[model samples]
Target chain A: MKWADIKEKLRWCAYLASEAYNMPYRSTVARARREQDDLFMLLIFSEMMGIPNPATYYTLELQPIMLERFHDWHTRMGMEHSPLDGFRCC
Target chain B: MHRLFDRRIIFVGGKGGVGKTTIAGALALMAADGGRTTLLVSTDPAHSLGDVFDMPIGNEETPLGPNLSGLEIDPEAEAERHIATVKMSMKSLVAPKMYGAIDRQIELARHSPGTMEAALLERMADLMVDARSRFDLLIFDTAPSGHTIRLLSLPELMAAWIDGMMSYRDRSRRLGEVLKVFSRDQSKEDGFGMIGGSQDEPDDSRDGRIKEILMTRRRKFHRARELLTDASTTAFLLVLNAERLPILESKKTLDLLSKFNVPVAGMIVNRLLPPDAGGDFLRERRLQEDEYREEIDQTFAGLRRIYLHLLPHDVHGVETLREIGEAMAEQLGGAFGAAKAP
Candidate 1:
């Protein structure tokens, strides 16, 4: 009825429409992102899984920044423990 | 001798205990004696340069003689230094609390396979680039055949690995940027901006810290690869004894180096018994050595050959090394002269 109230209601409507439009795409993107992150972690920490890593010395510096992501990645990959968990090598 | 003198870098490789260090030292001594400033770098973990020069030459370049300097890169020390450098850079990238865990991981990685070799190679790359302007020549007295081959091949492997990392980083960063815009999260965008505030360029946004690291390493490896593969700048000399196994191993090594496109400068046959030795035992060994010598000349016919006689005593200190150097200089005369022709 009032101009101010109309503007607020229209804003809420737009917000809801945007959310509805983005949900499916966001989920798909999120799934893809998780997969990519998993792949990245594998590439970096493959040596921890007994793979012969030629660049392990170069990758050691990255371990600190990716620790949490590495933990989550390992857990999601169905491992009961992190590859470097007990020693916290990840 | 002329080609080797003209080249900036020389890698001496051979079977274990083949007196590679001795021959490499002699070459370096000869180069230095010719008024060229030569840096002899021993990459062997079991360093004998100190013994060869009979001096306490550690990691630092110690003056072995006029225009000659010696450096023995202890693998363990180099590995520790490399780890410390990585950790120092990582301090800026990670939180304080994460240091302990990351340090532990790095320590484990230090002991991991290939870490020593990688560190040694990194040090070598550093020397090659940094010492290019400082010295007339750099002679690397490398580890045994297999180890040296692997070390030489590392630049290519490192290049491939860095390329993969860079592509992955690029993809991840692009996706992250796209997600940030699509989500329209102003707070998250501001957070990223704050995190990367140390860098202000728009180009900085495209490359994360890891990507920058990968790029730097790629560049280093690229330069090293270029230097290593260049026939004019680099030469790999095979050192062998007048023995069957050394001959066979040298042949195998030459094949491998050729496969890697590494330039084989020549072969040095060390510990040749004198032809006129009078003792029965010495004569018997000399007879056996003659057979292997013939095989070596036949097998490596195309390669320039240098022969050093088996000394009556152990070759230690500068005097004997000088003697060996004089012999090598004579043998290398035509080769070095020919190299200067073009």
Candidate 2:
């Protein structure tokens, strides 16, 4: 076999092995990702939280995209001792 | 003089009631009369273009004369237009059951204090980008110094703010893609019922629409900052009378503009006392004016200073603007050469 072909095959095998090793931690990583998103959304809505952000106008375009996950995000935030715990969206 | 008119973009600002609007109008008219297409824009909320031109000028572009157009930006109206756009996108993405709540949220945002300024800045960026191809020169008549300074400084602040948001977004987006690949089936099995879990991953991944929107805005602000700081193609002019307050205030404003890297062209010493005013009281007033005038000369020796004597009447009508324009052209290099660059 050519040296280049051998090197490519080895890289593919290493990638698969790393994927297998990361399988168990996948859920934790997902939860962390969700928390990261929640933090980002809070910054966008900081004005509504009584923090004055002049750049709030720039966040309006992202509102619709986040609308779907907001319920999932905010409710978890409500249990995590956030100021949003007592806040009602409606 | 020749250098001032050669710029592609010009901003006129000073203390309130300092005749900034008049100077900006006359300059725009002069550029147009010189056969260079020009646009005069008023960024002051209390617009006087309608008063200055003796015609109704609202948010839309209105022709002042041959090769000249004017626009008065109404911040409230601009904010409304922005809300309408947000509402359109929200209506499609939000569920019908949640429409009322989303509507109220948007309405609250509309009433926020900074909404108008945000909208105005966005509109200004749009004009700067859109008019690059259509006009030979653009002149902005800004509000009094403080407000204009705040508005001009926003692009730098906003660009930095957006950069922080962009880096955070990039991290989250990559994590999202990883979750889609590794935990998709397990998330379903865990019974953690996210309505979006079953749906397509397009909000931050797959589609990446917000990245495009953010990129467009970041690019616009960068371009606006570049144009504002370019001395060869952009210049900031201050219009003030020969008075103590105006002179002191102009010095402070000039310092601020220089710190921001904006090129300060010079000042127009408007409403000067005529030498021939024959009266003890008038002559006394003239003596006071000369002291201030001398002070201005000493303070701003490096700047191009043009002194305009007080006109006999309140400046009005196209004929009046034309006369002032001619004086400006005569003093601004004595004769405006056909100089422009893209």
Candidate 3:
């Protein structure tokens, strides 16, 4: 057998062996990702929280794409219900 | 002299009721008569360009003469229009399911305090950036003193804000990339057979879109600031009366303008009492006027000053503006007439 072929088979076996076990860091990575998303949304949408942003008009178009995550963000920040839950058609 | 008319952009500002609109209109007329295509724009929410011209000018550009065009931008209307345009652009980008909620948020933003000023400044910056190629001169009849200063300074403030946002976005993006690598490695260890497809990173379309929008605004503000602070191209004319209050206000405003690197073109002492009035009451008023004029000359020393007589009637219509323009032309003389650019 060629050296390259032997190396490739060994790597595949190692990957298959590692795949047999569960990982503990999965939940932590997910939480970090969510927090980053929340921070980004907050920077753009703080005008909605009664903070005056001069560039709010420019960011209005960003609302549609951010709408789905916005709900989860508000809830995670301790709101039992969405502020615009009544207007929610999604 | 002709130097004022030679500038690309001129901003006329003063205390309310000091005839800024009238002076701005006359300046525009003079520039146009000099064979330059001039645009006179009013940035006041409470517009009076129509009153000054004695013609019904709206929020859009209205031609007043062969070479002069006038635009009266209302802050409220401009804010609404900005919102509408943003919403329309979002129509194709935003999913239908989330439309109603986003629309409500945008409507609420319309009533916010800074939103109107932002919209107005954005429109002004747009004009400065986009209209540079189309007109020889742009004369702005600005809102009452303080508001106009704020409007003039917005480009710098917004540029700083954009810088902050841009850096924050870059940091967050880098963090996201790092976290993605970590997650991919963790999934690999768990033998999930390449979770998230291994090569497929999270969708960063939002970051790209936001960065594009911010970058465009930053460029506009950068150009606007450069144009505004370039003394060779921009001039700020302070219109004031010879009375104590306007003179004091003008002094403070001049200090503010120079401090901000805005070129102080000159001061126009509008509404001077005529010297030939033949009554004791008029004589007494003239004596006091002489004292104030002397003080004005002393206070604003070394600056080009123009003194104009108070007209018998309220200045209205194109004919009166032309007459005033001619009078101003005589006072300016032919000295310092060469346009200097460095």
* Strongest candidate by TM-score: 1
| Clash number for each model | 3, 0, 1
lDDT per residue, candidate 3, B43-113, as tens digits? 88898999989888887889999889999987788888878876676566556765776677678878877
Model 1, which residues run further than 4 Å from truth? A78-83, A86-90, B88-103, B185-207, B335-342
TM value for model 2: 0.86
**Candidate 3 wrong stretches, greater than 4 Å:** A1-37, A84-90, B89-98, B183-202, B334-342
Across residues A1-90, which tens digit of lDDT does each residue of candidate 1 receive?
A: 999999988976776686577656655655665576677788778877778888898877665456545656778899867667434424
DockQ of each: 0.36, 0.24, 0.34
Q: Tell me the TM-score of each prediction against the true structure.
A: 0.87, 0.86, 0.86
For model 1, residues B241-318, the per-residue Cα lDDT tens digits are: 989899889888998898889999888888888777788998898888878888887898888788888888998887
Model 3 TM-score, all chains together: 0.86
lDDT of 3 by residue, A1-90 (tens): 999999989987865554444233433444565676677677677777766777676666566556546666787878767655334432
Off by over 4 Å in 2: A1-24, A79-90, B177-200, B203-207, B334-342
Q: If both were scored by DockQ, which would come out higher, candidate 1 or candidate 2? A: 1
Chain A TM-score vs. truth, each candidate:
0.75, 0.57, 0.61
